[model samples]
Target: MKKDVRGMLKDFTDGLAAISETNKANVNAFMRLLNTGYKEGALSTKTKELMSVAIGVYNRCEYCIVYHVYKSLEAGATREEIMEAAMVAVGFGGGPSMAYSATLLKDSIDEFENDFK
Candidate 1:
């Protein structure tokens, strides 16, 4: 079935909040760490998002791909930059990365771009 990536993400996040309510402190801490790591530092946020897109492709995580692609766009990463990052993942992860780079990464980019429009 074709998934609405943005809707799926919203549902997942809402469910995650419900499940993590009992451990809110831990969840909040983890979120803080993620925020800190993704913030501009030595690397710009766009660079970090590109790196994340590569990692997401290497790992073949659909959720990761969707999330990071959306973030990469938000951080001003061009489609060319995202594709280059996916190619780097292919270098490291071989055939599997190639498959994801061609399919998942491309789909995520299209999905997110459509969502934003």
Candidate 2:
């Protein structure tokens, strides 16, 4: 969730709940660019998905970790790959962050596995 993003979630969720066409339009534009960069081309969207999970783990973003784990599957990432990515994040992100992120990521782990079946 990044450091300051927690404070912004309310407004963001509120805006989302309101179904503001303007916000949707603007976010769609951003999504196009991001999806192109991360999901298209030969960049291997799985890699980006893993990276997102790693960042979510590192930043301790509960919702982000959950969503990214799901998105990882939606992006064609495997459970082993996602687990390995989280392992790497644990190494680089350290004990507390690693532990916290693992707990958060755990919920999505099962869902991701089932998604493949």
Candidate 3:
């Protein structure tokens, strides 16, 4: 069966929140660390998001890809930029990354854009 990537993401996030609630302090700390790492320093948020897209592709995590793609768009990364980042992942990860980028990345981008429109 075909996956509903957006729905799966929502469910995963909801599940994560529920799990995190059982250990709020630790989860909060981890979230804080994530926020701190992603915050603007030498690299802009958009740059970080682009990097995330590449990492997501290399890792072949659909959840990661969807989340980072949405975040990248919010951070003002154009489709072209995201695609370029995916290409970079393909360079490192070879065929697996290429497959993920061509399928999952494209689907995520289309889904995200459609939702916003």
Top model number, TM-score: 3
Residue-level lDDT of model 2, residues 1-117, one tens digit each, is: 222333333545566556656577877776678667786556678788888888888777766677677778887788888878888778878996677655657656764567656
Q: Candidate 3, residues 22-53: lDDT per residue as tens digits? A: 98888889889879989999999999999999
Candidate 3 lDDT score relative to the true structure: 0.87
Winner on lDDT between 1 and 3 is 3
Q: For candidate 1, what is the TM-score?
A: 0.87
Off by over 4 Å in 2: 1-19
Per-prediction TM-score to the true structure, in the order listed: 0.87, 0.71, 0.91
Give the per-residue lDDT digits (tens) of candidate 1, residues 5-113.
Answer: 7775677678769868798888888889889999999999999999999998999887888789999998888788999999999999999999887877887787776
2 or 3, greater by lDDT: 3
Clashing pairs in 2: none
Pairs clashing within candidate 1: none
Reference-based TM-score, model 2: 0.71
Please give the lDDT score for candidate 2: 0.71
